[model samples]
Target: MAENLNPSRNMCSTNLSLLLILLISSPRPAISRTRVQFLPGFDGPLPFQLETGYYLFSYYWANDNDVRKALNVRKGSIGEWLRCNKSIPYTTEVASSLEYHLNLTTKGYRALVYSGDHDMIVPFMGTQAWIRSLNFSIVDDWRPWLVEGQVTGYTRTYANNLTFATVKGAGHIAPEFKPMECFDMFYRWISYSPL
Candidate 1:
């Protein structure tokens, strides 16, 4: 006796079989976080490589639009950023207020003020001027911090528990430029150990 098969049913079975094969072969997301190797001087084992500053900048801008949208910022033209929003004007009063808060209000809090020695965008001299205006007594005098038996930068601690540090051979992005020193400084500060 000859059996009759439904063409539609056969097609459905074939589709279901293909779907199961795909589902079985696909890679799964990791269940647990993998430990990262702390290689201070080099970037990555990043999932992908960023070759230069231009690449980093491009990545930042490309991602920034999504971030802005998520934050509910008013959208503008495509690929355009709204630089100014007619917000309150900036003045020295703002700087003084921040300085006051840092000097007097944050008694128990630990504050970290850092600069890249090579940063011209916001010069260390200007930062120093403002910090000096705070008049916080120096707990630790300015001295060079050593890494790999060489001077990495200078640091000083203030009576209010604020610390100022400079990263040598660094520019606007100090942490990126000197990852090892930045990590060391961060760890030491967070651990309440000497930096």
Candidate 2:
């Protein structure tokens, strides 16, 4: 006895098979790569390396739309509004805020300067050196800071109401890498408790 198949089902199957064959046989568009030599508002060819192509496009798409609207900023790209130039290299000498820090310290403003121990971009040693340059006596010497009975990092207090801390095992962005430990550190500092 021959097996019976629904006519509609048979027609659907045939149509799907043909569609798949067409899709598989169709030509794909060629991907072309073009290097960006310069950007608008920048004086010459890009000074630093320019990496193109799509790796993570979502980050580029992210913007503080609400913040811009609240701040009464006209509708424009955030980078343009901020006059940000990605080609410019960030260096300590070029981007030092030490003078402002000194002024704040002299005015008796308490400050917290925290660094990630694993942050090579802005190492803790550099932070220590700058803090020492302020000539503030040590109020609290370097000691282990704890979070939930575990050593989270090290902390030191300066005479000029300044505090320095190292977030242990954290990278450039400590809060992002060690959220709980960073939160505890921030909470303690803001509450005027020892880290």
Candidate 3:
């Protein structure tokens, strides 16, 4: 779904999506709860990539419009997403407020943050600002690991049970960039079998 996201273009949107994804996706943790965060640098724009800003700007700008596309969509998607999503109307304030609650107010939740060095939407550096401020518990040393070759980065497990990772070369769409690696991470996090 997130194909055009550049690493350095839409830090705000990218970081927001990554944050929400970590909070929202149904967890199947055989081990424990985990949250994965994506990094987007601070300042005006992202690092190397430049299209992210435009993508976010356009998304917000046209968030309310019907925006009729000429392509065919799966049946249920049109009813729930295309038509309904536009109806609910998610404003920047709403988005930000949700983030605050998920990141700070929620209880007993764990997160695993990851980023792609090549992503332009949320540059790795920009993502660090908020993450550094998190004051989360860190019990493990950050280490380099590869999922799919393109989805390789760092892993930091927190004392309270959060696990953060950075996927190599992935942008907003980490799965597309490195499906195997993403799966590996998930499987490991959800390791229900005896280790």
Top candidate by lDDT: 2
lDDT of 1 by residue, 77-171 (tens): 44443233356476654534665656553667778888999888877777788788877799899999878888989998887788999999877
Ordered by lDDT, highest first, the candidates read 2, 1, 3
Instruction: Give the alpha carbon lDDT tens digit for every residue of 1-195 in model 2.
Output: 002212333212123233334434636321212233443323576554333311111122123344345445668634532223467687666577778989999899999899999888889998899888889899989899999999999999998899999999887778756778999999998998989
Candidate 3: C-alpha lDDT: 0.50
lDDT of each: 0.62, 0.65, 0.50
Clashes of each: 0, 0, 35
How far in Å is the alpha carbon of 40 misplaced in model 2? 35
The parts of candidate 2 lying over 4 Å away from their true place are 1-95
Q: Rank the candidates by TM-score, best first.
A: 2, 1, 3
**Backbone collision tally, model 3:** 35
lDDT of 3 by residue, 31-135 (tens): 211222223343353333321322233333233122212133333453422212446756564534446635543475655566666668788776665565566
TM-score of candidate 2 versus the correct structure, residues matched by position: 0.57
List RMSD in Å for every model shown: 15.4, 17.7, 16.1
